[model samples]
Target: MAAPPCDSSAHRAFDFWLGEWNVHTPDGKLAGTNRIVSEYNGCVLHERYDTGRGYSGESLNTYDAGRKVWHQTWVDTTGTLLLLEGGLRNGSMVLEGQTTGADAKLTRHRITWTPNSDGSVRQLWESSEGNGPWSVAFDGRYSRK
Candidate 1:
């Protein structure tokens, strides 16, 4: 017998990230906390991140079976919404998207989550303006809290 569609490996590709994490900056200062849960029998991963300093966000992520790609929708307290799509690349879950800022300038965002051998996850967020150079927006390490 074959496994159900939702039980397939692709659907669980992001299982490594399902946990409560204490996120910290590279310099070792606490940046935030994150809680990720698997839902709908592995069809979706929901993420909530909070800095405990008035900035927080939540995202819904799912793997599009037909399109064979992963998609994420992120919304934050600042009234920002981002729709991103991508797949596993070089052992990382990289999702990129674009949005217009309040200044009406186009900005591109790329965020990557890579699980390290030490059981921590590294998240790197990069941004660029109108095809300009990409710069690091955020770099945080997540460990079990």
Candidate 2:
């Protein structure tokens, strides 16, 4: 027997980001590099990130059919872990999650990935605390490598 294809439209929502990329800050400063690959017959997106500063992380992203949402689990060398869940909205992949920081304070984290016309992707990560205004933690652009 052979495996069936994972060709659902929902599964391809994040396909635009599947590639090797050079991630940079909005002002064009090189921040890091990332490689996103489709695995398990497109059911999962695996990301490898390297910051060149002895830091690295990996994330596994997938779409949950029953929940109709995309989910991601990220773990970094610094022992930080984040789990985010959301769906594609307004042409961008947006995910939000809440976690308790090392200080034992609750925080909300949101990330959005937008595809640009020039074949690049923009990733914006923001955080908020206790209904406070969201602040950008990471704003980077991913250009094809």
Q: What RMSD does each model have against the real structure?
A: 1.1, 1.6
As a TM-score, model 1 comes out at 0.96
Candidate 1 lDDT, 24-133, residue by residue in tens: 99999999999999888778899999999999999999999999899999999999999999989988999999999889999999999999999999999999999999
TM-scores, all candidates, are 0.96, 0.95
Q: Mark the regions of model 1 whose C-alpha exceeds 4 Å error after superposition.
A: none
In candidate 1, which residue pairs clash?
Answer: none
- Candidate 2 — number of clashing residue pairs? 0
Candidate 2 CA-lDDT value? 0.94
The lDDT values for all models are 0.93, 0.94
lDDT of 2 by residue, 42-125 (tens): 899999999999999999999998889999999999898899999899999999998888889999999999999999999999
